[model samples]
Target: MGSPSDPARHLLDLARSRPPTLGDGRLVCIDGPAGSGKTTLAASLAALAGAPVVHMDDLYDGWDGLPRVTDQLDGLLLPLTEGAAGSYRRYDWVLQEYVEAVTVAPAPLLVLEGVGAGSLAHAARCTVLAWVEAPDALRLQRGLTRDGPQVEQHWRRWMRAEAEHFADQRTRDRADVIVDGTAAAPPRSPGRVT
Candidate 1:
């Protein structure tokens, strides 16, 4: 058994205890600012639950696409709610255009991770909403390091956009669980797989 304080374990337990809100499946929505470790937490939860994750990044049309994500999410999630396969046009960052459609079949569990994953329109359908966060400076540093300094302007713009979205959505206030993205992980025993 995992430790009582293990966030992934706790999240899994909560999900299992809840009634399915998305068709016959539970939807775990992980939303937070960029570089806030939302992706890492989603990966951990998905691995533990043997769930497939749909990244919001793939649903976004572009850097300025955050404001328009509800329509994209509707395309992806509405079908799933009816026990049908859902599909969304993936935005190709390099091509700067939407590419082929990605289909997601209904399952026992599905993880939606990234900004706008827990928008108001979809909140009622989420089994659990988790908000992960780190300090602004740390998040900015991480973003710059991963995306390169050349995209600093883009990062700044994105930061403002996400802040506005989060504020408008009251995402943090509605979160069922709030994780400290900067928290140090507990020490693991030798040879233990995370």
Candidate 2:
């Protein structure tokens, strides 16, 4: 096994150590504020575990979709918990609406990644809930760089919305692991589980 400080290794070990919570599959939720590297972490963990990732970005309705994502997750995860394949309609950002449906077949491991991916509604079913975070300034900068300055207003609103959601969810406090998004190396001493 790799060092426990390696987030991907730590998460994979955590997932394998736990009983499957999403039917025969284990769910690893990589959740955090926008631009905080949740996607990066999810990709790394998915690669390490050979898991399929369901991005919450695809489930969100639009700019104001954060609050409604829990319901969307319920729609996606409930079927999986019943040992059936799950699916969700992917939202097209350019079209500003939901379009095609994507099916997720139950597997040994699944990575759920995004802002509301660790909501209280499905916390009980998460085999590993990891919270990644960076400073607000850095996160805002990252968002603008990726999304462009044209969406700055949208980013601002989203940051505010996510802040409120995280507080309400108490996500960090409940995390099995807490990763520093700005760290140059894999996180060391991730909280709680370590």
Best of the candidates, TM-score: 2
**Model 2 lDDT per residue over 1-194, tens place:** 45656888988987898899999999999889999999998999999989999999999999999988877897789999999988898999999999998999999999999998988999878988999999899999999999899999999999999989989988887788888898665654344421
**RMSD for each of the candidates:** 6.0, 2.0
TM-score per candidate, chains pooled: 0.92, 0.94
Candidate 1 collision pairs: none
**Which consecutive 10 residues in model 2 have the weakest lDDT in total?**
185-194
| Model 1 lDDT at residue 21 | 91
True-structure Cα RMSD, model 2: 2.0
Pairs of residues clashing in candidate 2: none
Give the per-residue Cα lDDT of candidate 2 at 73: 90
Model 1, backbone clash pairs (residues 3+ apart or across chains), number: 0
| Candidate 2 positional error at 43, Å | 0.7
Per-residue CA lDDT of model 1 for 1-194, tens digit only, reads 34545767767777788899999999989899999998888899899999999999998888999999999899889999999998888999889899899999999999999999989998878888878888899999999998799988988999999999999998888887777787665312222011
Model 2's number of clashes is 0
Residue 178 deviation, candidate 1, in Å?
0.3
Question: Scored by CA lDDT, what does every candidate get?
Answer: 0.86, 0.88
Worst 10 residues of 1 by lDDT: 185-194
